[model samples]
Target: MITIKDLNKNFGKKEVLKNINLKIEKQDHIALIGYNGSGKTTLIKLILDLLTTKKGKIEINNLNIKDNKFNLKNICYISNENDLPENMRVVTYVDYILKLTLGRENKLTELSELFNFDIYSSTLIRDLSTGMRQKLKICTSLCFEQDLYIFDEITSGLDPVSKTKLINYINTELITKTVIYCSHILEEIVEVCSKAIILNQKQISDVITINDKDKFINQYNQSFDIGDLNHE
Candidate 1:
């Protein structure tokens, strides 16, 4: 389980997050949702230990996040930005990632078929369109079966059909892993995650679950029961 206790973040004189405490259990697919500049990325960076925190504790299982004692192989992360190698071909890049994860090239073929996107083995990464690069990035992450998957705005450049297909693939593949999905696309969030954490005003405003399609209706304050989010 991932434990966050009294977690807080600040930037210069601005406080980004305030006293955040939440328990992320196995198989918990949480959607971290907020408008722009709500400290969403900052929070994720903190969880990944990309930034140092001084106020509170974040731990995976029993090991503190700052301690860096946990096995990194258990984590698979997808960044929202375009960070793939520039000079490599799409298929070549995927193949390289496959080697690192001990995955097969056929998995790329499968993802290509699923997303309806062509994977030209000779096409350079710089030449691919935004949506194509996004598809390739997603395929890179799919090559692994890591225990914890963290996705940040993964659906940004995907077309509507491709987005739906990717969501379906995630639903089918990661049925039992711990996932943290961050996106401003509410509909996309509802499709991929069971619970949605609304971050606002440097704090978690509500923890909502997908009780219905499109409308993630929650008529009550969920601040009291983070553990029961999936049940709702």
Candidate 2:
């Protein structure tokens, strides 16, 4: 489980996150959404220790994230683009990541087959197309088994088909794993995440569960002055 309380962040004059509180139990899939610069990514970075926390308490499975006792063995972060190594060959990079995380090759092979992705094993990352890179990124990230998976704008530049493939994997393969999905596009995550967290005014404005998709989307659209999701 993850617990956060009284979280706040400021950049000189403007506050980013204010009095933020959230609890994520085991296997909870949450969608973190907000308008641009609403601190959604900051919150994820704080939880992942990519950014320092000055006035908040974050505990992952009751282990303080700010303390030395925190172990990231079960936590995995798949960022939009920063997580990938640009200079390495696709196969080499995957092997290196698997070696570091103690993951298996068979898993990557399976994901490759599932996505019909053939460039990872032979092409250098620089040579692959943008869509292929995103596909490779997902294949590499998801191949490693982790209790907590953090996806930060991971599908921003993918084609519709690739986006659906990633969404499908999150829904099917990660049935019981804790997932924190951060994306500006709500529809892509609504299918897999059980809960939706709306960030606004430098705090968590609303936290909703996905009991009814239509009702939830209507409410979500209203929050952002978005008339309808389908019209986007």
Candidate 3:
């Protein structure tokens, strides 16, 4: 479980996030949705300790994130950023990540097969297409068991078919893990997450359950223009 209280982050004179508080319980799959400057990424960075928390507290599983003993071994974070090494082969890179995280290849082959990445296992990271790289990233990260999973724009460069496969894989395999999914894709959000947190004006404006699709869509359109969100 994760608990954030009175979190406020500012960069110089600009206020990025204000008075943000949230609690994520185990087995909760959440969608963190917002406009471009709505501070979604800032909040996530704060949670991940990438940004210094000047005004609030963040605790994961009862341990303060600011504590010196805090660790992220039980948390798996995946972003769209090009952080993977370009020179490593697909399987080698996955093996390296496994060695660091799980210390063993738990479901490594299964995940590769799920994303249809086995065909390119011997290919170098630089040679794979954008979608293949994304798949490789997901396969490597999700292969291990984790208490919390944070995905940021994971389906950004994926094709329709690949996106569907990733979403299905998450819904099927990661249903019990605490997940925070950040994306601009509306339909996929509704499909993958049970709860949607709407950020607007540097704060959490709403937290709605995904049960009512039309109601959630209308609420989202009201807070942030529907045109800015991807519905397909």
lDDT (Cα, 0-100) at 167 in candidate 3: 91
1-232 per-residue lDDT for model 2 (tens digits): 9999999888778888999999999999999988778898889989988787689899998899877888876787877774566778877887687786664778878888887787346677887777778788787778878899999888866888877878888888898899999876667667878898989889888888777778778777667644422223
| TM-score (all chains, Cα) for each model | 0.87, 0.91, 0.92
Q: Which ten residues in a row have the lowest lDDT in candidate 3?
A: 97-106
Q: What number of clashing residue pairs does each candidate have, in the order they appear?
A: 0, 0, 0
Question: 1 or 2: which has the higher lDDT?
Answer: 2
lDDT of each: 0.79, 0.81, 0.84
C-alpha RMSD between model 1 and the true structure: 4.9
Best by lDDT: 3
Mark the regions of model 1 whose C-alpha exceeds 4 Å error after superposition. Answer: 118-120, 218-232
Encode model 3's per-residue lDDT on 1-232: one tens digit a residue: 8999999988999998999999999999999998888898888888888889679999998999878788976788888888889998877876677667655464877777777777337888898887878888888788768889999999978888888988987898888788999998888888899999999899999898888678778877777777876656
Q: Candidates ranked by lDDT, best first? A: 3, 2, 1
User: If both were scored by TM-score, which would come out higher, candidate 1 or candidate 3?
Assistant: 3
